[model samples]
Target: MRSNIDGKRLVDRIRKYYKADDFQVSDDGLSVGKDFYGLNKIKRVEVRQLGWRENAVNIVSLALVLSAATWAFVPQFGLIALALTFVIGFSCWRKYELRAEFIGTDETGDHWVAIARGCTKEEYSVFKEVERTMRNQV
Candidate 1:
């Protein structure tokens, strides 16, 4: 697991890499650049529950892995395959967190950004906070 310090460093790196003319930071760890929406800029924040495609792929991969494992001659390989199958199955059934995206257009072009993700209250709050901040700021 990554420590808080590591996460902080990563956030710092992203901020530095994507420096914008304007930015907003929230206590829940939400940050957005004014240019996140590109030349058009995002005028609204939308909370979207994404990941259906990933969940579907994980389910399909799990089926394939289990079938291959069942045919494997080596018992050890079967055991490893079973472990992987379980992990994939769990991920497919797990509750996924909602994702935040910026949407808007600019004179130059359209812009969008996927900000944060996690199955935690803090993560959800971050989305709400960002929306509130954007409404008030822009």
Candidate 2:
């Protein structure tokens, strides 16, 4: 696992990478970035899959693996035992963390940034500065 300080730095870097022009302030008093171009700028947009549901499927597969293990002691089930463990248990492990993100890679290439909440001059200065930096990098 990454250390807390490293995680924070990484988050800050991402924030800098995706600078935005305007936004609505969030409850946490942090200037969360908003994609002003709205839906038009977004392509290949998708929602996150339910991780809990995938986990449930994996658990069932694992249960089947255990059952196959026990039944292996009986007879022919032994050959299939190892196979089931590999197929079912592996599938369970493979589908653990499934998430979706708005990834845009068009003429501008892949870039994602957010404008900080608040239209104030100070906030815009900071937000614009970050956006400028990101755009320059592109």
Candidate 3:
């Protein structure tokens, strides 16, 4: 998951992975370049909603963390439990609020997937906009 991604930085990364000839985003979000995955073709592009499977895992992990904090007090376990709790909590919050997935299929039948999960709202918005623009073109 990526967070606090600068729009300019994100664009730079995209350009780095995909050459100017390989991938291009139009000023109007109308025309788009292919050459993704060496399959210079675009079949369909859409913003996909990630299901509850991941969320469920986070929820369960959080629950287990709480239980550990309450019931387990081993000297070594305390620090580990606290750390795990913090991680799980952040993960749940991110999944619930910021992250979104965009998937595009190339003509050669390969899926190009990008996930945007940011800690800050501004970062999340930037990535979301990029995904939306790419989806609109296709």
> Which one is best on lDDT?
1
Scored by TM-score, the top model is 1
- Alpha-carbon shift of residue 33 in model 1 (angstroms): 12
Off by over 4 Å in 3: 1-59, 62-83, 86-88, 95-114
**Could you tell me how far off, in angstroms, the CA of residue 8 lies in candidate 1 after the best superposition?**
22
Enumerate clash totals for all models, in the order shown: 4, 2, 1
Provide the RMSD of all predictions against the true structure, rounded to 1 decimal.
10.1, 15.1, 10.8
* Model 1 Cα shift for residue 24 (angstroms): 4.2
- Writing each residue's lDDT as its tens digit, candidate 3 over 29-110 gives 3222432221134434443344467556766678676757655667566666666776656544443132223233446544
Residue-level lDDT tens digits of model 1 in 1-138: 579889868755653332222245433343454323332244445555556676667676886778576757666577667667767665444232323334433464534455544444545565565556655544
lDDT, candidate 1, at 8 = 69
Q: Compute the lDDT of residue 85 as modeled in candidate 3.
A: 74
lDDT of 1 at 71: 54
TM-score of each: 0.36, 0.22, 0.32
- Model 1 alpha-carbon miss at residue 26, Å: 9.1
Better of 1 and 2 by lDDT: 1
Query: What shift in Å separates residue 35 of candidate 1 from its native position after superposition?
Result: 12
Candidate 1 lDDT score relative to the true structure: 0.52
Q: Report how far off residue 128 is in candidate 3 (Å).
A: 3.2
Deviating ranges (above 4 Å) for candidate 2: 1-49, 74-138
